[model samples]
Target: MVKKGRPDKRSKTRSQAAGGGGGALPSGELIGPFDRTLLYLAVFLTGAAIMMIEVLGTRILGPFYGVGLFVWSSLISVTLIALALGYYLGGIAADRAKRFQLSHGIALAALATALIPVFKTPVLLQTNALGVRAGAFTSALLLFSVPLTLLAMVGPRVIKLCTSRLESVGRSAGSVYAFSTVGSVLGTLVLGFFLLPMMGTRTILYGVSVGLLVLAAVLALYERARRNTLGLLVLPFVSLAIAGLLFFLGGDRLPSTPGFTTVYEAQSIYGRVRVVDESERQIRWLLSDSSTIGAIDLRTGEPEFPYLYILEALPRFHPRGRSALLIGLGAGQLPKLLGRYGIETDSIEIDPEVARAAKDYFGFNHPGRLILGDARYEVRRLRKKYDFIIHDCFSRGVVPAHLLSVEMLQDLRSLLNDGGILALNFYGYAEGPQALPAAAVAKTIEAVFPFHRVFVSSLQTELTDHVFFASTEPVEFKADKVDIAPSPLGKLMLDNLFRYEHKISSDQGFVITDDFNPLDSMQVRKAEIYRHQVLSDISADLLAR
Candidate 1:
């Protein structure tokens, strides 16, 4: 029988062993309603924070390392490893250390999160020399491991704190994990759909860090109040001050280029888009991530890239062609030029920002229809046929593998008229390790259309852009039939257009399909080479900004 007005000895011992918490009943409810609420909130926030950082990590590392297979693999691998380690360590600490609390882990994670924007640039620059695979993995480990590990610890600790009786351990674990997983789902959706498109990378990161700090503060205050420890009342404020100071030291600033002025810069759903002008050179360029998608001569008001001229002259291959379809409207130069030729052109662009920048900064005024969507999906939706189709979506040192698959080529072929010609642009080495991507593309095109011709932008057999013209009928270029007025550079390109014609053997590459496409793996070395060149040409500070 229990004594009146006296605590049971077993209950007193259990409370003391739990380090200032009251004894739990058989139901395993060791915490009061207030304590349970704070614990669940902490778990929820940390779970959300982990996912937020994972998504934001891609944006932070993309400009330098690219948002490709290797980078994503590295980020995912690091996250899993850190979480595993955190779970193992947190379980041990929770069981052994009487003074350890969930608030401590949250506070530490807040500090680690604040350090990311501060040290990311230097860390990435250092790791970049390690090459793509190793560099991307190492950078992810250094920048994200500490915070993800700390945040991951919250889950196990919450589970331990909530489970007092061994009999109810299963129920407690399930409930705690349910809350955490739900938080992760919400975090991913909110970040991808809402936060990233609306705010810059740095701003979103700072906001996440601040949010974690606030959660940590609330948890710490609650813990202190529950323990009635007046001496530790200042701990939460001290952590906030230190985290705020770190954030202040790591503010984001745009880096200045020596000879160019940035006309506009913004983070889009696709990537970082920027318009930069070289006044002395009288040139302007539209950049997406680390790749220059389009450039124009400010003085002559003509597309500067030689590849654009090649595409413009493509219609010469089909003299009777009146209506055309253009894929990947970079600067809208090709369609604008086609409109000038009195040919009705319809264009498809995946990124809205690219289209906006084309109109606002690149003087892209297309008389034809501009459809905003992915070419792979948009091509299937078109009911009308065209005389000519141009595919130019290759960028960022890699092609969209889905666009180059056998199925996609078949779809593009289906959208063409009887005598229609399809032109595809690709960038890679003509012969060597990097030649596989280009060769595979050639093989895939041949799989759909029997008649095709390949043309290189430069005479050199090294890394360059190759344009392919494919059709059911024989693909031919009639120079005498071309009547459009050409810029001096365009004239130069036309003079040597046939000289750039080359061929890649079908045996050199396997056909790419939606089911089995190894293009990402095949082009790793090529991507690394291209990214290194971009890094050498542009300031690292500029890319970081």
Candidate 2:
């Protein structure tokens, strides 16, 4: 029944049973133990690269689009769809070919990865101009779909090559998938904890490219006798071309601030941190995740943010505060101000890099004020009491949902002294659909504190910083009786006092509780509007110049 000059099935069985011996091919090519080893490595690296790409995709898109739920959802959906399609196509190709070669797929994926850095800036800016939802979807598609699909194909093709008989198919598929999953887990941990922090995104991408090319070179050497010499010789030049392309096209270009230059920039697990100095105005800005966290005017050592002036009104309500607690150490300006008033201030900041940037760039080196960790957990763990507590934690354009819940307010109340004042800085529109977020926050605070007052940072501004002053004792904003100060900063604070308004109850609207809070959902429309406005502002500024 056997054909003439064809290797017998027994030779295939013997090689597989030997667990790494010479495997006879039914078609033609010989596969030794080392070749089999390369096959497994190919599958593992492919799996690892897929997850690494997905996680890094967030960091890549976060600055322009934001790392919100929308971007994440889009990344996941696109990856899944691409992988599914790749699996089907891989199976068809494996069936039609005389032999399954995984090296080609790996090489293609490597080339694609190398090309990502070159395409990132142009592709992201073009897609983002289309708006967040469409932009996030299209960007993910353009950037990751092709590479991930090619990587996905490696799995099935590897399985096909490794299997000698129909009965061993189950073992072959399971072994390949198991290695791939393990590699994915390792990639997530190592890259997130070690590589991402240690290297730039582009540098890490280049490392991945180099690793793949090395694997491809080794595979090509294994099959060199097959006369694939020309392709092998051209690979290095192609890689050089990709690297050269990235260098020329990957540079960031934005509207120049007339007298400002970047002082520092770093990427951390939390996000991107940048410190930029405006020399003409003598102001330095601390930006996290592409949003301004705080700005300081160097000429005057006082905070430039108008909402901070709410601190000036604190003593009028609760005069004898000896200690204070500040949440969200944004450039440490508030805490520094509190220290000047002789109030011992303790500040909690979630990101240590943010704290570091504040201390290094903003001169937030006050002794005994910085506590690095989550505000909610740290606040709950604190056994000490404070006369004044300020809640100022924010991410991008919204307050962290966990910090704005009713239970969080109740916990803050426990941390306050008998007559302590709690000041909260929130941003939202006054009367439009954007007002809903602030209104919901006010309602949640009201649910916990019976006495609270709302003050808009600017009387003429609609969607801006709104500070809430809440206390157990009766609070007052006696803007008329107070002797208005002479300094420019003092005058601004005094003028802001006139905009004080009573809190609006959210009895008819949604209240944010720990159990049922959709803060991101509530801010979706506003965020979209805000994103467009921000992009327009930058574009207009660039065009004007």
Candidate 3:
């Protein structure tokens, strides 16, 4: 029988364990309040760092592989695999070891994260030869797998450390994961909204590595203080030194090009925007990721891309057009060109960085309104109508399929005047599996506008940029009627526009709608080919910048 004021032996043991007193487990020890707080903080920081690294993966791999479906797929798949393996291995280690230190996993993770910016160039260069799909996956795995895996282990070990009683195991695990998930949410928001735009990829990566190392050091100091051992505390300091050494050694300077100089470079939510100037050739290029979105002759200050010439000529079909709407303002060339014809142009640009680069470097000085937002949403908000609407948003070898759906075309059509012409620029092959996206675009455009004409930028039938002009009435390009006094190259392009005309059959592709748009999947081959061509033309070191 138990005394009225005293508890039984078993009940006393259970109470002590639940209360985190001595004899909580076989180790006969438990973390104090301060130590437990540090552990939870570590878990939260690791969670945030994991998400940050994952988001940065796209920006890191985008230069070589492009930000397409394959890159996203590879990144997501690799992250899941790393997390799974980490969870399994961490659970096994937690169950086997009598005592586990969270600092060990964190320190290793910090080192791994630090290695990314250091080894990214070599890893991407080697994997780039594997082609887009395999290269993106392999690059992501080689660079991010270890760090993500190590960071993932923090959750299990933290749950183990926080759970002092079997009865509290479920609650402890829930609490640990909840903190991690909240950290992830905050990390994603901060990275997308602020860090990527302000710091760029390499800087953000270095910061994340240092932050994780600091967390590890704090945990190490706490653990060492509790155990009365000073040796393990040196590990975090040593790791930090190595990380700092690597960061300084692995600088983020752009590699030198033989004849070109980098005039400007920045990171946007869309991708990396760079301006490269070739003095000898008198040409400057505006690049988004690996693809050259716009180019201008430094000597003449006129657009050099053949597609832009075709776009400029197509607007002449609607002779009475006094106002124009330009979507995807690359270097603001189209708007500037339209302004030359006394046409007031309103440009819708998605990335403010691109707009700034265009004005500062490319000498874009259009006196019209520059609306900065997604074309799909911004088009719906516009109350005014336009005589011509131009769509040229292709960049980084991937099309924004959402913007090309039948629904989006209808919106553009709604904004057009009766004789208004809608010109779209697309990049793909003319006749092959890669041609499906272009064919789908043509069909979707035709579904909205009855008459249209397609023109290719290059004479070759291979992968190239194609311009489609659609209107309610017959589309006509009277080159003889318009006398804009184009350059020799532009004149040549204008003269041969009909020679480059292509008519894609409806059967080749179905109408792409918002509910069922397969344009991304269909353009995979084309994107790979286009990216490869761009990569071949430019040095890998230049793109790595």
Could you say which candidate leads in TM-score?
3
Clashing pairs in 1: none
Q: How are the candidates ranked when ordered by lDDT, highest leading?
A: 3, 1, 2
TM-score for each model: 0.91, 0.85, 0.92
Candidate 1 local lDDT, 1-545, one digit each (tens): 99799889988666444442321112233676776777888888888899999988888788777788887899999999999999988877766654666666777787788778888888987887798789889999999999999888888777767766656668878888888888999999999999987888877877887788788777766767656665443655666788778767766555557767788877877887878786667778777877778888888888877887787776788878888988988877887777756778888998888999999997778677899988988998999998988988988475688898999989989889988999999888888766888898898998999999998887753778889999999988776887777656767887888888888887888788999999878877778778877676566666665
Q: Which scores better on lDDT, 1 or 3?
A: 3
Clashes of each: 0, 0, 0
lDDT of 1 at 131: 84
> Which prediction has more favorable TM-score, 1 or 2?
1
TM-score of 3: 0.92
Candidates' lDDT values, in order? Answer: 0.80, 0.73, 0.83
Clashes of 2: 0
Residue 432 lDDT (model 3): 71
